[model samples]
Target: DAGITQSPRHKVTETGTPVTLRCHQTENHRYMYWYRQDPGHGLRLIHYSYGVKDTDKGEVSDGYSVSRSKTEDFLLTLESATSSQTSVYFCAITWDRGTGELFFGEGSRLTVL
Candidate 1:
């Protein structure tokens, strides 16, 4: 099984504050992604990295940024948190893009007051 971990599984912050969530993986997978789940909007991709120092923005990438300094770790940061950004974030990994299977971390819940 793929080994995935996320830091600060639960977080609460005031509006306009900055927040960062970290995701670490031991699987050495080539592709890692960050997503947020919410009602009605479903799951939306925030960012993803294909290799070390290689990253790309996704659909809802406006307030989110990602960094992949190494193959085993990916970080997602919210430059300035907002109420609308409150949601459960997830980290996922996949070795084969065509496989349609992704290994996901437990989740990180963020609340902006």
Candidate 2:
């Protein structure tokens, strides 16, 4: 990964609150994704963007949304944070879809009470 960063590496919020996590990349990768990691769930995709303003829902898209208006940044937002959504969220980037190679940012840990 040439450059990838996740903001607010850690956060704590009350239930029903709104939260947004940011993932930014410097290499202008064409594919970016948001995934949540939890016990026994491994990594479940929440959303992905193929290019600027082009996004699609993923396996676990409920209560989550994503946007990528610029090639360098991807945003993952929870309309209303809930206890069930508490998990470590990760941002990943890939050069292309066929290569199956993905580079991930450090991660963002969210705690919902």
> Model 1: runs farther than 4 Å from truth?
none
1-113 in candidate 1: lDDT tens per residue? 57999999999999999999999998678899999999998889999888999999999999898889899999999999999999999999987555857788999999999
Tell me the TM-score of model 1.
0.94
lDDT of 1: 0.92
**Model 2 — TM-score against the truth?**
0.96
Q: Model 2, stretches more than 4 Å misplaced? A: none
Number of clashing pairs per prediction, in order: 0, 0
lDDT score at residue 113, model 1, on the 0-100 scale: 98
What lDDT does the true structure give each of the candidates? 0.92, 0.92
Question: Where's the lowest-lDDT run of ten residues in candidate 1?
Answer: 94-103
User: How displaced is residue 61 in candidate 1, in Å?
Assistant: 0.3
